[model samples]
Target: MTFDPVMPGIVLAVAAATLLALRAVALLPAARAGRTSVARWAVTTVALLLLVLAAARPVTGSAAGERNAQRPQEGANIYFLVDRSSDSAIPDFGDAPRITAMRSDIEEVIRAHPDARFAIIGFAARPSIDWPLSADAWSLQPAVDALTPYPGIDSTEVNAAAAANILRYQLISAGQQFPQAENLVYYLGSGAGESTVPQGVFDTPRIDDGAVLGYGTGPGEARLREIAGQLGLPYVPRRDGAELPSDRAPESGTATATDPATAPQPTELYWVLTMLATALLLVEIYLTTRDLRRTRAVRRQAPS
Candidate 1:
């Protein structure tokens, strides 16, 4: 229940006006006669409206949220660790290389599972959070769109270190509310030869997460990237080459990606607004009926 304003002031004003109007209507004699408690009704409407508006969370620009599945599913929290360092610039995978392809893949993943709380992180010579764990894919998607290969300092950190950082953050944010079996990590990197973090970092007993995918064709080929501004800085070389490590045993995991067409689309804000309005209307109807009953009782008791 948070509100970000693309037009915060306007939304607040509208909400306030609506609340006042409801209050005025509730104060009228006909409306007043039927309520168990008008004050309580007014307060409840306001509270409900606030909750609805909080979902609005107006942003300066359009943002997307994942729709509920046709079959209800509890959202799984997942984190993404990306290799954004200078090395991805090696024209590694796409015509533009691995970074762009990786970015596109991320956007697709988020588009499909927009409701999933996710964080995007970049590791090169070092690690920095591109987007923290959030349900509001509104901001998170943009963070994905803004992925660039341009120069930042030179510091390459291992994907494991980044995963560790992501794990730490998830624990802090979810706290007691954390769902068991809810957390997963996807590390999409070249698995560059050397990194400071332990190889089993994602395999520990404390957090039984494992790296899902690796990109690049040859040995040490996956680790290629450059931070030059030609592709606008932190670009992975332009090649479609990727590899599943020969050393590790293969297993089916949740990290398998969906086709672009079949991927999920975002839930529209207006639909949410409509549902909220419908709920409010139902509440109003109930209140009206209750009030009518009270008025009838009053008349019955009045002198004929």
Candidate 2:
């Protein structure tokens, strides 16, 4: 048996001992018989021990189960192509910064597709993977939260074709890594905003699934819609109550997606321990009250 004590074992031991000692001292001048006093002391000690056990939080499982907790499975791979251009920092989205809106949208998509693994590509002058593909959604939070628009790069001069090429490369790389998973790309930006694309070089890459999600309060939405049309992907414009279209990714049904047959299961035993401790406390209370009543009855029977 192993113990994962909430507090240090020595600290709990000292607390239990100190409490019992204080109780023993309080009960010394009582009119109860020696055996009754000892019985009360034992009950108190048992109650204390039960409480400590509950706090310790014991668990029993094989070593193999823990090691396989994060088993990979077949699901969609979501790639977030986020634009961190200087234009994205404009504070017009819901009267807040556009970057704020982008973060919210990315998180919303993550929650929507619980089964899918995710990667993040932050694009300004050029696109690069801020976060690699992983099933752990929380791993991408810090990078997104700390996202700031790159300085000294004019959004007007960004090359859309070059940025798209980087995205294509990352998507192909992720596809190679997880061949079984479907690729879904979510573009969170006002696409190609004032970014020049040389004539005959505006070729849009083929995306298997997902849409171009536009975020702005200006003419960028029109440009984004054009980009989406060219890429043959659906366009979702930012609005007060806009929703991502249904064709993006497959939804997780009633069953939890993470817990596939191959994944290990984690079982918690804290609730059982807590219940046991509560039962012990009730028993201790009953015994103490009964002993007090018996002592009072004996005193009443004695001559005064």
Candidate 3:
């Protein structure tokens, strides 16, 4: 069980206490005048408490269930190795720059795997991790959107394999940390540069699934296919109006929809609390109305 309060704990506690105190004070006169009974006051108090508990938003789940709910399907980690080389600036993918297509595809990938953790690495003059691995998928949008072409003056040549070593290191570390998890690598680049590093740098067994998304129809397209082949991943060319291939399905081993452990756990008990509070409030209202009517009838029969 856990609580995701609608407000700060201190604030909610103080507000609830203050509300109960005020309600007691307001109804004291009615209780003393015989218009509201002790039972009525007690019901109202319980109702208010129930409302406060509802606002606290208690969640109930077993330890294993909670762990499973937090883990992505098959505990997949998606890595995006983007090319920021000067060739990426080439406006060859249907007049738009390669970065534009890369951004669109990255966004689509993120949307495709809402539960997967994501990391972004951009390579240009050298390799840099633009975004670390995070479960908050949407948070990578700013980093992806900010990617630009590497300055042509910074380096004479663009090496697509510049980030291969770093990527390999990261993959090895990820495997160590999560031996059961799958690593999906998506390399988005124009692949215009020569392979300065040795081949098979990205052929590690850690990469379980992914594709090399080539953005332009330029001469570098062939080189991009080579990079894909080296990584043992499929190469998919992105054109202006063509739809992306659906080969990158979200399903993984032991994480299928039929698996009870992978199913979404119920994490909210607020609605049940709210309904109980409402029922108590209705009971309080009925009792109060009945008391008031009886008191008025007795006064009418005895005095006027």
Better of 1 and 3 by lDDT: 3
Report the Cα lDDT for residue 75, model 2.
57
Which candidate leads in TM-score? Answer: 3
1-304 per-residue lDDT for model 1 (tens digits): 1233333466677877777686677677546567656655664665567555655553222222232322023344667777775555667464676677778767666665534567777766556777766666775766887776548634334443444555565555644344443454555666555555433233222333424444555543333232121111132332354432221222565432122344354433534554666676677778779989999999999998
Candidate 3 lDDT, 1-304, residue by residue in tens? 7775655699889989898888878677757867446667777888889889887767676643564444443456888999898767878777888888888888887877655668899987578988877654544788888998867524346667667888888888778655666788899987755434432345555578889998766566887888888888899988887776744554465345324455454456877898999998998778779879999999989955
Q: lDDT scores for all predictions?
A: 0.53, 0.67, 0.74
Best by lDDT: 3
lDDT of 2 by residue, 58-107 (tens): 54566334523332334577888787888777787667777788888888
Where's the lowest-lDDT run of ten residues in candidate 3? 192-201
Models 1 onward score TM values of 0.46, 0.56, 0.59
Instruction: Give me the runs in candidate 2 sitting further than 4 Å from their true place.
Output: 1-73, 196-206, 217-219, 246-304
Residue 264, model 2, lDDT: 41
